[model samples]
Target: MLDWLITNSWLVWLVLFLLLAIIEMMTLDLLFIMMSSGALVALFTALLGWPFWLQVVVFCVVALMMVLFVRPVALRHLRRGPREQATNVERLIGEQALALETVTDHSGMVKIGGDTWTARSSDGTAIPAGARVAVERIEGATAVVYPAAGPGPFPAQ
Candidate 1:
């Protein structure tokens, strides 16, 4: 049994690679895939009839290189969406809204794109009703805002 395991070491590496790849698919975090890359290198080394310890060394080096270098590049390319494509929440960040009532730092109401939202003044000052305002950011269920008259990088409605 022991001799079979020793001679069939590549099979072990192949199983490990498959297992790690499955885990990487489940996680989608790019961690186990890097390790699987190492296992693949070890499998190739075993197929070449290399010493077990040398195969282990090659695995370690390849895994480290993949984790330290390749993973970041892969994450950068695959994980993040294009900057211009905003999510539903992200789309509201710079949207213009109409103050439905006097908005202070504590509480108020506003209509953004025909939907009413809990609102707050960004600077703690009171904003009168019917004023045009820009959505600065969102905190919990509240929309923090400022007067649209001020200079800001946010787009106009």
Candidate 2:
């Protein structure tokens, strides 16, 4: 069986390529897609009557190029997603919390969603406890807030 497979390496390479592509569909992480491309390149080389060693070399070169160059560019785009300005979902945007403790000169604790978080006022004003505040931004784990005045952070809904 082994000897026969070595003789018909193109079939083996083709099956391997197809298996990789199929698995890639399930995984969706993009790593196997690169391997699948190399496998297909190997299959093509084998179909062209190239010896096993040359086919292996071509597969390795193609796989390396795909991994090093193509994958990074693809992943970078995938990681960032469409660059539509900062929204409320990101940290400290569109959040309402109460000042847990007195905020004096830009330092205090604010309670939001049943959790206490370090907070600061952008205008550097001292806020008392039990004050309704609006999250303006976040630095690290801390949330910057301003007193809720006039219309609240969220409009009537």
Candidate 3:
């Protein structure tokens, strides 16, 4: 069987390629598949009457080129994607909510999107209870806010 496989070199290459492809299917990644492509090229060369050493050389060159060049690009393209943003602060940007707790000196707490968040007024003014506030920025777990247009601590007097 070994002598027959040696004499029929193309058959050896084809069988090796099939085995590599099977492994690739089991793994579901691209590394073995790229190497299998190089093996297939060598199989074609052997079928065209190239010497055994020449076929080996072709296989080595092709395999090296795939490993050095194509693999990085394939791995990068097939990598898992980043997750979506899903925090309360992420949802509060550009939204307005009522100040549940008073800000005596530009600091307080507010209920935005049904969640209470530590807050600070953008302008140096006190935010009173029942005042509408707009989210200006997120700092750590806190929300920097600005009082909405209307009567606040400084009523339009």
Q: What is the C-alpha lDDT of each candidate?
A: 0.89, 0.82, 0.79
Top candidate, metric lDDT:
1
Identify the runs in model 3 with alpha carbons over 4 angstroms from their true place.
1-3, 80-157
Which tens-of-lDDT digit does each residue in 53-74 have in candidate 3? 8888898899889988998898
What TM-score should be assigned to candidate 2?
0.58
The collision pairs in model 2 are: none
Q: Which digits, one per residue and each the tens of the lDDT, describe model 1 over residues 1-157?
A: 8788768989989999999999999999999999999999999999999988888899899999999999999989885676578776677888888888999999999888867899999999999998888999988889999889854342323
Two-way lDDT contest, 2 vs 3, winner: 2
Candidate 1 — what's its lDDT? 0.89
Ten-residue stretch with the least lDDT total in model 2: 83-92
Q: Write the per-residue lDDT of candidate 2 for residues 1-157, one digit (tens) a residue.
A: 9878877999989898999899999999888899999989999899898988899899899988998999999998887755365454463466777887987656899887667789888678988987878888888877888888865444222
On TM-score, the candidate that comes out on top is 1
Per-residue lDDT of 125 in model 2? 92
Segments in model 1 whose C-alpha atoms lie over 4 Å from true places: 1-8, 26-29, 47-50, 60-90, 149-157
| Model 3 RMSD in angstroms | 8.9
User: What TM-score would each prediction reach against the true structure?
Assistant: 0.64, 0.58, 0.52
Error of 2 at 113 (Å): 17
